[model samples]
Every structure is written in C-alpha cells, then in structure tokens.
Target chain A: MVNILANPARFLRLAGAVLPWCWAAAAVTGGVGLWLAVFVSPADYQQGDSVRIMYIHVPAAWMALAAYTLVAVFSAVALVWKHPLAHIVAGAAVPLGAGFTAICLVTGMLWGKTSWGTWWVWDARLTSVLVLFFLYLGLIALRGAFDDAERGNRAAALLALVGFVNIPIIKFSVDWWATLHQPASVLRIGGPAIHPSMLWPLLTMAVAFMAYFAALLILSVRAEIAGRKLQALLVAAGRNEPAADGLQGEAR
Target chain B: MTAAVTEFFRMGGYGAYVWPAFAFAALVLGGMAWRVLARLRASEGALDRMRDRAEGGRP
Candidate 1:
C-alpha cells in the first residue's frame, strides 16, 4: 500500500479511476444533505432557524481540522521518509485546509451574531482556530519563500509539524474554557448529543464535504506532479544541450 | 407558492445571517474548485507543450 501510494504514476492512475466516483458521491450526498438541511430538518426550539447554520458550520469546522491534521501527518512522513509525494500531498492540502478554516470562522461569526449577540470574541476555541488559520498561511508563504524548491518544501514541512500542537488545543478548547462555541456534540466520549433528525443531515453533509475534499486534493496533487514534471523536463533539455545550460540554470 | 419560497428564503427572520453564511461557504468552496481545475489544466497543457518541444515540435 505504501509503495503504491509512494509511486506517483501509480497514484495518478488510481486517482484517475477513483476521481469520477468521488465527484458523483459528493454531488449526490451534497444534494440530499442540502435538502435535509433546508427543507426537512426541524428548527431548534431555542436557536430557531438560525440553527440551520449548524449544518454548514459544523462540517466546515470538521473539515478544517481534518485537513490540517492530514497536512501535519503527510508533512511528518515527508520529513522522516523523505518522500517527495508526501510533500506534494501536504502542499495540496494547505489551501483547502485554509479555505475550510475561513468558512468555519466566518460562519461561526454569522451564527454567533445571531445567537451570541456578538460578532467577535476572545475565547480560547475561537482564538485557537484563528491561530490555525494563520498557521496555514505561514505554511503557504514558507513553501513559496525559498528559491530552492526542496528547501522550501522542507521548511514548510517543519512548520507543519511544529504547528501541530494547536490541533489538540482547538479540539479541546471548548471543554477547557467557557466559550460561546458549543462542545463537540457528534464526536465525543459519550455518544453524539445531537437529535437524530439533525444528526443524519449533519453526517451526510460531513460525508459530502469529505468527498469534495478528496476530489479536490487529488486534482491539486495531479497538477503539482505535472508542474514538477515540466520543471524536470526543462532541466533535462538543458542538460542535453550545453549551449542553453547557463540560461536554464539562471532561469531556475 | 411564492409565499412559501419567500418564507424559505427568509429562514424565519434569521435570513440575513443564514443566507450570507451559506453563500460565503459556497463562494469559498466553489472558488477553490475553480482554481484547482484551472491549475490542473494549465499544468497539463504546459507538460504537453514541453513534450511536443522535446519531439522537435511534432504534433
């Protein structure tokens, strides 16, 4: 499994076969999930219609943390095993992770404004997620900072591993502190605290988001692989003909 | 029919907050999808062109 995953050509072929199914799953599940959320689910007794926001908010928040953990794990593998594809996967994940984090934060704010009567807060859960957003930004900037691509990948990998401490902080912050954000309702030590009517839709949406993430992650990794191949080809061409060697070296 | 549609959109008086939240999530996710597709297309195109160049510009 590791060998197949580590081989880019094989990985690409596997991804090609799986991509269509992923897109189909995402579309089907997302449509059903939306229907359930918008039309089928009952309004919360306390939060009322604003509770509808939970469908989007909870899934986005879950994806945000999940994506970052993926990055950190891939980054670790890339550093320890020096697998180039692992770095590519990690790099592909950063933007999507950041996107999810942004969605979570913004939707949280909107939900908060309705329920909490405030747009901003300095609570630990909120603050930690904000830090997570910046960590993603820092990794992106670091990845592109160095002219040497390998150096940049290594630097970004290091940053990803170092910043992983915040993951637990974000997960536990609600329980650890008194925050406006609710505690983990679906994924907790005890069974999900949520009602079944709402739970099914939320779970479906989570599946849809994950499928979407997988499809996009595959696409981004393929693009990064192609980009790397193009660079390698340019370098090889320069090597065959010594006349343009200086120019190619300078170009790089 | 129209009343039901309006009520759905209104989201029972929290429409302002609810709609924007969902809309922003759509925008971000949709934008990422667009960008990822563009990147894949551009990179594959470049690779094809480079391969053609290696083959002495032969199609």
Candidate 2:
C-alpha cells in the first residue's frame, strides 16, 4: 500500500479528492467545538471562566505531540522505504506541529499565571515540552541547511527518530514528577475524571483540531509538490530541455 | 447572553491574562495560514512564468 501510493501523481489525485472533505469537516467540527466549549460547558467552580482555556490549550498540546509523532513515523518510512512523498509529508508537518506546540506553551503559561500564580515554571512537564518545541525547530532548520535535498531529508529523518524519545517523556512528565501541570484527566486507564458535559466538548474540540491539522497538512504537501515540479521545470528550461520531457520524467 | 459576555470579557478577574492568550493564539494561527497561502501563490506565479517562457520560446 505504501509503495503503491508512492507515485506522486496518484498521491496528488487522492489528496486533491480528499482535501475538500477534510477542510469541510474541519470547518464544521471546529464551529461546533467552539460553540460547545464556549457556551455549553459550565465554568469551573474554583477557576471560574478562566477554565475555558483548557479547551484550546489541551487540544493544542495533544496536536503538538500527535503531529510530531506523525513526522517521526513518516520520517522513518521515508528513510527505510526511500519514499519521496514521505519526506515532503514530514517536512510539512514540522511547522504545524511547532505552531501547535507554541500555542500549548503560551496558553499553559497563561493558565498558570492565573491559577498557579506564575507566568512560567521549570517543572518537568513544561521543560520537556519546551524540549519538544526545540526539537521541531531543529528539524525545520536542518531541512534547509543542506543543499542536497536527499541528504537533508535523511538527516532530518534521523533527527526526528532521535526526537521520538521525548514524546513519551513529555506525556509522562506530569505523572513522574511533582509538577504544576495536571496529570492525564481525560485519558486515564479506567475512565475520564471530567464530567460528561465538559468532557464531550473537550473531545469534540480535540477531534476538530486533528481534522484541522489534516486539512492544513494536505495543503502544505500539495504546495510542496507543486513547488518541486516548478523547480524542475525551471531547471529544464534553463538547460534548454523540453518542458514536456521534464514533466514526463517526473510523472514516472 | 449579556451576563456571559460580561463575564467572558472580564474573564472572572483574570481577563488580562486570558484574553491576551486567546488573541495571541488567533494571531499565530492566522499568520501561519496567511504565510502558507502566500507562499503557495508565489510558487504558482513562478510556475506560470516558467510555463510561459517555455511555450513562448519553443522553436
């Protein structure tokens, strides 16, 4: 299945067909999620209305981890299978993951300021997540450092694999340490610690954010493929080669 | 609705921190999306220029 989908044209066609549905789902689900999060869920008794930040912060944190995991998985596939599209997918995921991670950090700080009486802390959870953010930046920078695209891809893939160790550390940091950040509430082994009303909206928002990431990732990958094709065409034109031949060579 | 709006704006006394955080998130998300679309458009334009040159100078 991976080899079959390795063809760029086939991937492009499939991505194009699915892209609209992904965007539509993101828009609809995000709308509903926001409605539920903002209006329906009751404010926390102690934290009051400031508790609303959980809706956005939790989802962003989840996506940050989820997106990095995706990049690492795809990077491994790209390295092992030598799939060209896998590198592009991994490249596209980095910025989005970084953005989500940034959001998580910022919102967490804000929540902390109000609830924990500090803007920041050097707790295990916060520190590990900061490392995760740096790992993302490192991958993005490494991708652009090498002139040879294949070498850059491989190096970045290796970095991603090495960074995979941090994801678990970030997840378990709250559990493993006396931290300001709360431990897993919704993802507990037995059942969620949250109320049904609050839990539903949080889950909805999480799904919506995941869909949003999917839509944005597809867009970024399509743009990357188009940019690669354009670069090849320009190179072919500069060499006085036929554009038709250039495109045909690519399609193969 | 009015009471909810007032409470949200006031953010239950943590308005300063809460509102700015939300605004910052919006800005970051919006800025990233804008940058992606802008880059895509620029690449498309470059492709069009390349295509035109290839076609026009075809012998």
DockQ of each: 0.64, 0.51
Number of the predicted model whose DockQ against the real structure is largest: 1
Error of 1 at A54 (Å): 0.8
- Residue B16 in model 1: lDDT: 99
Off by over 4 Å in 1: A239-252, B53-59
Candidate 1's residue-wise lDDT over A56-141, tens digit each?
99999999999999999999889888879999999999999999999999999999999999988999999999999999999999
Displacement of residue A102 (Cα, Å) in model 1 is: 0.3
lDDT per model vs. reference: 0.91, 0.86
Clashes of 2: 0
User: How much of the true A–B contact set does each candidate keep?
Assistant: 0.87, 0.46
